[model samples]
Target: MANFFDFGLTLDLLRLPFVQLALVVAVVLGLLAGVLGPLIVSRNMAFSVHGTSELAFTGGAAALLLGWDIGNGALAGAIIAALVLGLLSRRSSEYDSVIGVVLAFGLGVGVLMLYFYKGRASNKFGLLTGQIVGQDFASFALLMACAAGVFAVLAVIYRPLLFASVDPEVARARGVPVTALALVFAVLVGVATALGVRTVGALLVLALMVTPAAAACRVTASPLRATVLSVLFALVSAVGGIILSLAPGAPISAFVTAISFVIYVVCWAVGRARGLTRA
Candidate 1:
């Protein structure tokens, strides 16, 4: 059995270039998830995020099969899915069903693409789960650029988006362009989800994108405080997960999800205690 607490091995792995790059990727992913997660939860778009990630996986798989850039493909696939969902489910009643239909189709297509690809098993596996070593400098650069773009776009629309998310009817009455904001926000989420799929894997991207924000919301009602706490939680989960996985040589997503869930549990306990004290 491998020693889970091998400090020496952990230190050695940290010293390698790929591992260092992976850490940077995790940081970027954490920040992106943190910034967008609260909005996703507030707007009840968690299912939409999942659907976006699945389409991202499909895009990544298609990229592997076609010998193209996985990140680019994933981004394209995710945006398309977001647009489709947005257009089809303009009514709140149809939202969940639209996501379900798109998710199922995207997953089936992703599976078919993976089946046809006879390349490295790790590449295919990484689409569903995650692998860090495959990220070279070019891919890293692309990830950085995409992250910057998402941040810039969010900066321009954050207030309106938040307003729309919290109360769409009121926001629309105030001429906030709620529908346009929703479409833009969905695309932004798709971009973030695509970035996360590369680090946390499509199957478990929710740990970073939703769980941290959910935990933060449980403890705090203030939007700014929730965003801050969510970022902190996501950073700890992503970076800590990578560090812990180093010695054990385990999948990063497993550790990431585990740490995220633990944080959520702790926050839940604290929130429950507070509620009881108030009562």
Candidate 2:
């Protein structure tokens, strides 16, 4: 426990090959999740993040069973779930019901797959929880490519997409192809969620993806500023948590989630204070 605050140990950890790559993964996932999170909140699809991640879990489990790369399985599962959810929830009235069913089913599938894997237990736990170490160059490069694609899509669709997210009816009236845009955005969110699942685990992926943006939104209504702050908050949480966990032999997910939750709480209080002071 004495080494918990040892900066020297943390710096030494950064010298490891896997640790170097994991840091890069943290930064990229942070930025990707940050960009998509506010839009998810605004569109009221926060629930969908969890649902999609459950499917990502199933995918990772399946990959483990088949000896395939877990990241590929996770990304495929997430994208499939996102597309299905988008199609099924075309009418807002059915969004909750459809996603709820999908979430449960995904969990069951993952459990079944994991049960038959017969591998070291740590690998299974890592999928459900998170592991900050053991990252490889191949996985890191794939993640970077996927992140770039996701960001490019976001840049192209952001304007009309934002409009559609804010008010679908209005966006539809403006001929913005709201349905198409929503489907595209959900797929992008799925991509981010998959990367997040790899970084922080499926259970805690939403913390990186949603909480920072949610906190940022509490303080700012401007989309651009909120996006920037969300990215900033997520980046700090990802990189800072890794640094803190290196010396203490703690879980990266725990530190990351705790940091995100603290940010949200502080921002919420500040927002409340601003409201009172204004009134």
Candidate 3:
């Protein structure tokens, strides 16, 4: 019994600098994505999240070329892309059309930047798959600031945003500015996407933002409960994935995605069993 309980050796890695940084990264990304993800999924903007993340990839890649902070670069890219999408598609019902055009342009730009970059291969690869374990204190601090800003804005706009998301026509009929809210939420989602790309990489940003919320959605139709559960699921996936990555050769994103997928599957099964699933 004593031998079975002896688990001290495996816990030593938690004290390492890199591990600590990764944990912080995981927490910030988890909370940010968790908070914004339900809103995104509710509005059927999961595709938009991917589109914005790819542009964020372009921005981060360009930042690597110019020797700037990749997170900030990604943030810049997401904001620009989201605003452009919102502004251009405000009066049009063909948002998918606009997103498709932007996605192509964003990917092309990212490829061009990667083509010309003379940095270490890991630096370029990190934009696609993340490199949070190597982050410094300054970067960590910057991440905290970004997280704070995202949460602050969310706190201010959560209720109206929820109303707008659930029913844009009803929200507008009740005097809510649906268009303005959409633009604001788009910017917020863009910021969250940039932060997600920083930790989970461009290729897997949606894994964190969409999967956990989707899983939560499957289990509960109550928006409040669903959002809370989504946050919990994201926290588990992010932190659990980081912890699992303490093992050699384990990629954090892979673990995170797997955990999220498993959670989604479990929730789907449960929802089906309870007749919570409509179809």
Candidate 4:
């Protein structure tokens, strides 16, 4: 087993260019996920995120097979999945079923693609469980550019988006473009989920994209407060997980998920205690 307590090794690893790039990627993904998490929760799109992530994996696998940029492939696949889901799952009764059908198909296709790829086994593994070395300066720059676009779009539509999420009927009655907003938001979520797949993998993307926001919501009803707390929680989980994994040479997703789950549990306990006190 690798020495988990090797502080000297950890510090040395941290100074490496790849490790530094991973840290930056984690930070970007953390902030993006944090900002999007609350909106996703409020809109009841957690399952959508899961489905999108799988399609992203499929896309990445396809890219690997075709010798294309994996990040771009994943992003394209996620965006397409988001659009399909947004269109087909318009009704509440059909939402979960639509996601289930799409997710299953995507996963199957992804597996087949992986099987056909004669490249490094680690590349296939990375799509499912993240590999920090998969990131480079070029991909990192693309991620940043995408993140900036998402933020800009959100800045313009945040108020109406929040309203539509909270009360779609009222928002529609108020002349808000509810349907359009929902589609746009799904695309934004797809982008973020694709980015997260690089750090936490498609299987565990929710640790960064949903858990922090869910924890924040447990503690507060205010959207602004929830968003702020969610961002902080996600940052801690992502960065801390990366740092902790360095010494052990373990999978980063494991650490990220554990930290996120712990935060959720703590928030749940506090919320329950507050409820009991109020009663």
Candidate 5:
């Protein structure tokens, strides 16, 4: 058994710029995403996770095709995709179908474009599987700024957002702007997904965000409690995963995901036991 504590000590020793930035970005973004992901899952927008991630892929592809800045293309793609989902979510009836269509088409287009740009493997991998670990101070600064901005927005909207999430009909009846909340959340999620692709990769970002939160939620019914637990779990997973990956031959994604899965299983079991005891 690898000691994540000692493993973590190793990471602190090398201190590569890329690794440092990754650790910071992952910890910050993972904390925010885990805190919010459960709320999103409660609102039954799980599909939106997949949709936004695919759209992010398309954005990276476009950036590669146009030879523009990768981050710029990704942000643009994410914004456009989130707008579509936000609008569709208002209908509530056809939202799933619309999102599914968009996700599929966007993924197809991204794959095709990647095929056309065969030589841009580094960019493709960065957007797709998250291999780009090093960021200049400027990029790291921008990522931190985005993370801070997102954290602030989420904090400001937390109360109403939680109310609206648990019961949209009641919240709306109480005069909460559920529609606007949805739009804001979609945009935030879109941006977060784009940024997260840098650390967790598009494939694993949702796992980092949603899984820890889901696990925490199994143990706590109170929203605030769950949020706190979720953040804690996410931080553990990110920091632990980074530390594990620093060891001789470990993949960060696998380590992080396994930790998250373990947490989820433990929480699920505890929840089930409590339910049975109640019965």
Candidate 6:
């Protein structure tokens, strides 16, 4: 514990450029993930998260194969995959199968591309495992722009999305555009997944996007309160995880994932206790 304290103090003293940039971007992106994740889970779009992330892996691989930018590859893959999901959601019944095929096909394509790009092992490893320790100025700007866009779209679609998520039949009866809301949420989730890949890697993207919100949901039944708590939890995880990851004996992924899981467990226990008390 003493060593950990000293390590944290040392980090506070040395505000390196990469570390600063990473913390800023991670906190913003993490908050977005936390806020959106619960909505997706409550709406039963967890599989969509998996589908988009898998397709992102394929996009990154293809970009490498074609000598293109990896981030663009990820974004393209996520958007295309989101489009497929949006289309499938129209039928409702076929959505799961569509997601399954998209996941499988994306992984297969990624594997084949990785095989062809064997010489760039480091890049491949980073794309898969998330070795981006910092964002450049241009990347930071892009992240901010994307974050703004996501928030703007969500603001407009929030009501309908919430209604549809909580009760689609009721929402439809009440004249909510369920189909449009689904598509909008799909696009938002895709963007979130693409943004998340920068910090968490495709393999563990859910760590950033799902864990915090799920944890928040356990502690709060109210949507607004849960959203606020989720954002806080996500920021804490991102900033704390990044700092811990920089310590002498810790990996960032381990720190971030552990923090997220711990938060979830704590919330779940608290929620259960509250339930028991009520009973």
**Superposing all C-alpha atoms, what RMSD in Å does each candidate have to the true structure?**
0.9, 1.1, 3.5, 0.9, 2.8, 2.4
Model 5, stretches more than 4 Å misplaced? 1-13, 132-134, 248-251
lDDT of 3: 0.85
Q: Specify the poorest-scoring 10-residue window by lDDT in model 2.
A: 129-138
**Model 6 lDDT-worst window of ten:** 245-254
Better of 1 and 3 by TM-score: 1
Predicted candidate 3 versus true structure: per-residue lDDT over 1-279, tens digit per residue: 343233463377788887788887888888888888889899989989999999999999889899988878898999999999998886647888899899999999998999999979887777888765647787788778878988888899889999999998999999998899899899989988888776688988889999999999998999989989999999999988777655443456787898999999999999998885455
In model 3, what lDDT does residue 221 have? Answer: 93
* Collision count of model 1: 0
- Every model's TM-score: 0.98, 0.97, 0.93, 0.98, 0.90, 0.92
Reference-based lDDT, each prediction: 0.91, 0.90, 0.85, 0.93, 0.78, 0.81
TM-score of 5: 0.90
Best by lDDT: 4
User: How many clashes in candidate 3?
Assistant: 0
Question: Model 6: per-residue lDDT, tens digit, 70-187?
Answer: 7778888998899888986678788899999889999988988999995557677767766545257776787788889999998888888888999999999999999888887888
Stretches of model 3 off by over 4 angstroms after superposition: 1-10, 276-279
Q: Tens digits of per-residue lDDT for model 1 on 65-154? A: 999999888999999998999999999999999999999999999999999999888888877877767578887998899899999999
Q: Assess candidate 4 and give its lDDT.
A: 0.93
Task: Write down the TM-score for model 2.
Answer: 0.97
Which portions of model 4 show Cα errors greater than 4 Å? none
| lDDT for residue 170 in candidate 3, whole number 0-100 | 93
- 1-279 per-residue lDDT for model 4 (tens digits): 547778899999999999999999999988998999999999888999999999999998899899999999899989999999999988989999999999999999999999999999988887888877888988999899999999999999999999999999999999999999999999999999998887788899988999999999999999999999999999999998889888887778888999999999999999999999999
